[model samples]
Target: MKKIDLSKQEIEVVQEVLDHWQEQGLLEQSKVRELRENIDERGFEWKALARYAFWVALASLIFSVVSLFSDDTLVKFVERFYETPNLVFCIFFGALAAMFYVLGFRNKKKFPEKTFSNETLMLAGSFATAACIGFLGQVVDRNTNHFTILFLLSIIIYGVLSVKLQSKLIWVFTLVALGVWFATETAYHSDWGFRFWGMNYPLRFTIFGILLTVFALWGQPRISVLQPFQSTSYVVGLLYTMLALWCLSIFGNYSDFAAWTGVRQYEIFYWGLLGVILSLSLALYGMKVKDSVSRDIGFVFFLLNLYTRFVEYLWDNMNRTVFFLILAVSFWFVGRWSEKIWKKKSAY
Candidate 1:
């Protein structure tokens, strides 16, 4: 009895399908009319507007803070406050984080429909928590360059909070903190060198990503509390791996830019080849398994690799107009192919 509010395009698609069904004698005219009557065309997309407004508000808040600090009086006030003990900052931000979390939880419980606002509060809490941790680290600083411990602490704190709150936002911060810990820990062990056991940063993260992805696929599903985070973990792990692979394709295993430039492009072709093979393999595997996330990542990165290769191989050799023309045609073909697939799926 409830009318479904849909966009204009969606309404048209439903109408077209109803018309087709009536033409084929599959649906009665009266039934088609009734279905059409239940479809309400939306005049505006308020959800999208709200999402954009929230982002704009965040940007404006940042600009406002910048503008406030640009004033000489405010600048002097902050300069005087800079002499305050790190312990004070730590306690202040820790209290702020607690307040935000409490408010976020209260709102989530009382007004569950305010999804964006609830998450925004949680995000603010996460930032405040990070600031609290950072100041705590500074308070205990021994000039040992062992501040990587703070990240480890963050991983523990954020992980506990995420599970307690069932918050994907906090879980994302937990993952980010884990990555920071891993990277910094490795760098510290290697005495801040570019290579750790002959593996550069990208290579190191590629391995880390593989391990994370494997754990998400094999381990997370078995753990009851972790199941909710499985998709986020899987997606983030793949993004890390694919992005690292892209970087490897560009820079190879070289430690520095100078070394990379000295080596011929053909010498590093193997990395690119490996990236292409993995991308294609993932795409095919995703299609077979009906994993939409994997399929999309694989396909997108496959195209990215091709475009990068096109630029690397043909940029100097081809005419500027011809290069862009080929690029445009390729994108057009891709759009047409996607449309065909969408239409076929819709027909079903």
Candidate 2:
């Protein structure tokens, strides 16, 4: 017999039904477990791989297109124009982006089941939007290097498009653009240096990430426009926060590696302390609020932070055999603990 695939929601509904039947004495608990075991609840791996492969293919296509212009003959031909107006390129790419977005939108509306094709169209539209923005930057004056302006423009454009189309993919671009704008705006105002309000890039981004996470949690419940994107925002915000915390653990408030290396480990240990504390705090808060996403992010990053410190501080002093042995033991313990929890849950 061929195996049938079930989505998470479908599996959940079936499980709930099984539980209801079991409660009514119509089914045995053991039978419920057996039925669930036959159904595949975690089919995310292949879907995730396919999505990644699609993006990789899209990137390769873009790279191939750019490579064509890298030919000597094509480059010289293009350089032949002393004043190649970038505005033309901007308009051209803008039109292409609009075309792709419209096509993608129409396809989504008419054939919503064609997810892969819809995503492909949206990806192409995003690339076209980037190209248009790049040319737009080139066409403008270069005196006041407010490059962040372009990022801000991208945010507005992407944000409007995302909301109008109710597209999480485009909203992701908007979030990225917002991050770029924040970094560039801070750097430009700080005279292109790392020190922003006495904080380094990672530290600043840490604060920004926390604020983003909070706003996502707070806004989604109240703002109807943002409800669809709540989960995306939460995940993205946690990623940013975790990454910044990782960087902060290594570099502290130093602007560059040279400066960080000059300082002793003990001197910058406070940053590491802060990182761990923040992770734990987030985890605890997650448990308090019953938010599994936040809790998982915190717990996972807490372990990562611990391992990072081990590698940074112990690699030079510890023996290779001892290091690997410690890692093996640690992972074994974690596995055993996880199995124990799983068994207990299964019993219940």
Candidate 3:
């Protein structure tokens, strides 16, 4: 259970949090098995620091992303004006980077780290910040000096935030940043421009998928929802869908010489195959988890099927009511089935 300094609401929620922790014992077990550390044993000891760190990680990520995409005239003007080395900016950035390094560096622990609660939203914020900074570096089109300065500065500031929040998500995020760095450093020598906007790198996509999968797997020790894990599920689902799209797009026939725009016949076949396979897989998984995980996954596949049928509707533009009715009926059946499974599990 988390203790909130500000309000009774946080204190009142303690019971719910305890139930949540008990329910999520699976994750606790997994972590213990992996790290040989008793994270679950720590209980509410790290709540405040972890929570704060999580927020900073999230904020840092968001700030970095926004900074990268910022079209702000003032920002641009500042960049133009202070184009050279400035001790003031350097000092400003240096401190934050130092903090980020200290917090996120796994081995740099003041004392051997023991327990930690994962905070998905906050860690996402951290990753987003790194991404934004990376993007900004890309935009500036520099060799190393400016980006390194920014990167270092951000690492310290956000790093401290990560510690304060005790966000495991930030730790995950740091891993991702490391991976991305590895990718860029190895293939293109820290050339992010090519990777972000360059040709499709299948391996990179695969890596991204793996990362999302890790998030999803780690998030759900049990079926209950939380801010971080739910986000992971959504991301995993989205990435899986994107993977299907990317593969199909690859197989589709395109114009050899002349310009034309339309999906190929092979594309339809691939999508249909994926839809069927995913639906079947989800239904199979439904036999295990009595929660909406399988149901939601299956829904994505069903939605794809509906889309294909709707495309056929476009050609005929008739019997649209039948299509809608089929969707409604399918939704109802799935809803009932899900309720039955959940109720049965609860009764047990």
Candidate 4:
């Protein structure tokens, strides 16, 4: 019989459960022994190792290319490379992107188990595509900063490719491109001002994040092809929302550090309070709906807001030792509460 391999912690949990069942006369001792014989603790985490290896390999490849280009012998070649026409570079990178995408698609079909490798190829293709778009932008430079068009083009291209290839990696790039386009387009409309329509970057992005999250929750589920990407989109949207809110809590609507420094920390108290309230509300809603992702993010951001407030309001007035002690106690209490909740859930 094939053995089931599990992590040490998982094996321990299974053992404890089996022991409890036997003690309660729910499972036969012989049956428990048989089950135990078929289970083995995994000796290593090859999947994690493979993931790290792939990223390291990619970094090394990049470094090697950079080193080769920086060599003294390649000075003339490097200068000439820079002198090369934007259109030529654009075409070259475009071809490279096409080749990587084709290869990645072929690999996905032929060896479905090589998930990391296939995704890496797709990642390379995405980078190449971005380079191609950038060069294309340079090729059509008209002195005006119309580079926002390139980001829009990237969003369209990546969006199409993601759907066609059913690739989460490409979809992530599409979302990133969308964000870039949104930021640049807004800035352009505002004449590159620090504030757009009386809102700073953080405030503007906070609104953008809310809209993105709403779309992910309500709009994404309606599309059949997008169902697979729903969770990713939701998480990314939430991350954007939470991060922007954090920034808003710190910076409020201030466009510059100097402006922010002129106001007391209490002046931004409303923004922090808003973040805390929203996070708490989300946490409650997530718990009611049994949404783990929402619950985790909400709880984490709620704690973050509390910590930020603690520092902002009490750091100068309180002793360092007392402040750290309070933080430590709070963390310990939270951990104990979380453990109790985990136990209750496990019992159920």
Best-matching candidate per TM-score: 1
lDDT of 2: 0.86
RMSD of each: 1.8, 4.5, 11.9, 2.2
Best by lDDT: 4
User: What TM-score, computed on C-alpha atoms, does each candidate reach?
Assistant: 0.94, 0.83, 0.46, 0.93
Candidate 2 lDDT by residue in tens digits, 1-348: 344578887877778788978998999989988777788756676766767888888889988789869888877887786486889889999999999999999999999977777878887898799999988998884567888889889999998988887788999988888999999999998999989899889999989998888989897769888889989898889889888978988888889778777886767787788878888887888878988888888878888888888888888889999998998899898789779966775555
lDDT of each: 0.90, 0.86, 0.50, 0.91
- Which portions of model 2 show Cα errors greater than 4 Å? 1-53, 62-83, 284-290
Q: Rank the candidate models, highest TM-score first.
A: 1, 4, 2, 3
Model 2 backbone overlap count: 0
Tell me how candidate 3 scores on lDDT: 0.50
Q: Candidate 3, residues 30-137: lDDT per residue as tens digits?
A: 543443221233335456787687667767866876786576875776677556544444444445444544454443344334333223434434544654565556
Report the candidate with higher lDDT, 1 versus 4.
4
Positional deviation of residue 100's Cα in model 3 after best superposition, in angstroms: 4.6
lDDT of 1 by residue, 37-106 (tens): 9989898998888788877877787787898799998898889988899999999999999999999999
lDDT of 4 by residue, 18-135 (tens): 9989988999999999999999889999998999999998899789778877898877667867878889999999999999999999999999999999999999999999999999
